[model samples]
Target: MVSDRSKGEVSNVEPTVCWVVALKSEAKPIISYFELDHQSGNNIFPIYRNDKLGHSLIISGVGQINAAAATTYLASESGAPPWAAWINLGIAGSMDGEIGKLYQGVKVINPTKEKVFFPGYRFSKIVSLAEIQTLDYPTPVKKNGVLHDMEASGFIDFATRFSCNELVFSFKVVSDNSEQDMKLIDKMVVNSLIGNRLQQLDALLDKIITLSKREKQRLQIPDEVEEVFKQFHFSVTMKNQLIQRLRKWKIQFPNRSISDLVKEAKTAADVIRNIDDALTDLKFDWT
Candidate 1:
């Protein structure tokens, strides 16, 4: 995937991790740590990238709608591949956790919409996990054990559409607790909170990157399958089915050529059926 930057140069690296942050203050530390270069001329959202690291960051303004829109914007602008990981990292108000503590959201609940999202593989060994609740407004009042945020719900909802839930994650650092004053949080403070947890973030990213690479390898379109598409016109649904069937065939008969089975196939349906039949024959043979 290549993205045309404002300077007219194209980024050759396809990002493996996309970070959606709600505030510039929250994004400051990450951009510096990753050494991401800002892309000029994108007025709607502040976009930053480090192609070498395969990491991209977008600063979405506060609110659920903004978060969702920015996530979509980043995906479009970056030309992010389907196998890329999507992460929403920022600060949240927590009632039970200590201020500046970082946590991975295991379960995200949108109270207003009554929607629940369980995202990402649990990095239990790397950081503490907590349940997050997305609210429309900032509530200084305590909410028991839930971490309060305004963006995770929207971020997760839109992000999962681009990538699987297993590759989408929300990690928040406690910026304000019941004992701490929200008004006291300045840009420097927000940066510090996020910066302090870079070590933990590094560990999480290592795991996520490995998972994304595995997914990329699994989802890669075979050259033979691409040739088949050139020969036959397949609808979106048919294309998906064909790809799925080919994946099974490749696993079952790695040394065999899928083209051999589909050479007699006159249509997309025939190609899929042929592959399915081959897989079935192998299953029965083993039994």
Candidate 2:
């Protein structure tokens, strides 16, 4: 799978990870570090990609909805595989941290609505965890031992629908807090903060991509289904159903294949119903 990164001098390897950020400043260091180039021609929003680095970034402006939309665009436009990792990385306000410390948001809460999102497994022991609150605005609200951001909730909400829960993450670099002022933190400072942590982030991203690929392998449709798929003109929904039922069908009968039964089917619907019947028979007997 060759990934396209506009005019950027990147390799043919496609991106396996997507990063969503709320500000261009926050995205600057990552784009530079990964050697991403702007593809331009985008009228809906701005995007950058690095085929060799296996990363695609979206600058989602500054809010919850923007973040969600940008993430959706990343998944859609990038045509990322289900194994591709999704990360929301940017600066945030921390109640108790130095100006530039980094954190992985293990728990994300929308304080305005009291909605909570627990994202990703705590697989990386080296990274510190933070309890983050996603607020509606950039109001200076900070609490003892908590991280404050504006986009995490929306990003996590939409990303998990495409991949496993373990592949979604919210990474934060502290920019302000109860003592530190938000007004003082400018674009240059944001760029510098994230730039300083590229080394650490590079390693973290590698871990996430590997884990996502493993999870994808666990859930991806098998190659055997391809032969059957080519014989029929299946709708999008039918294809999904076929892939899912095929996996369950194989589990029910290790030696037998539903492929032989599919040979009798005349339409996509016929194949689906045939697979459904096998699945129904094996439901009680499958051990």
Candidate 1 root-mean-square deviation in Å = 5.3
Whole-model lDDT per candidate? 0.88, 0.82
Q: Which residue segments of model 2 deviate by more than 4 Å?
A: 1-14, 232-287
Off by over 4 Å in 1: 1-12, 231-249, 252-287
TM-score for all predictions? Answer: 0.81, 0.78
Report the C-alpha lDDT of model 2 over 75-193, residue by residue, as the tens digit: 88888777778899999997777789889999999877778999986755757888889998887857878888999999999888866678889999999977879999999999999
- Cα-lDDT of candidate 2: 0.82
Q: What is the lDDT of residue 272 in candidate 1?
A: 84
Task: Report the CA-based lDDT of candidate 1 relative to the real structure.
Answer: 0.88
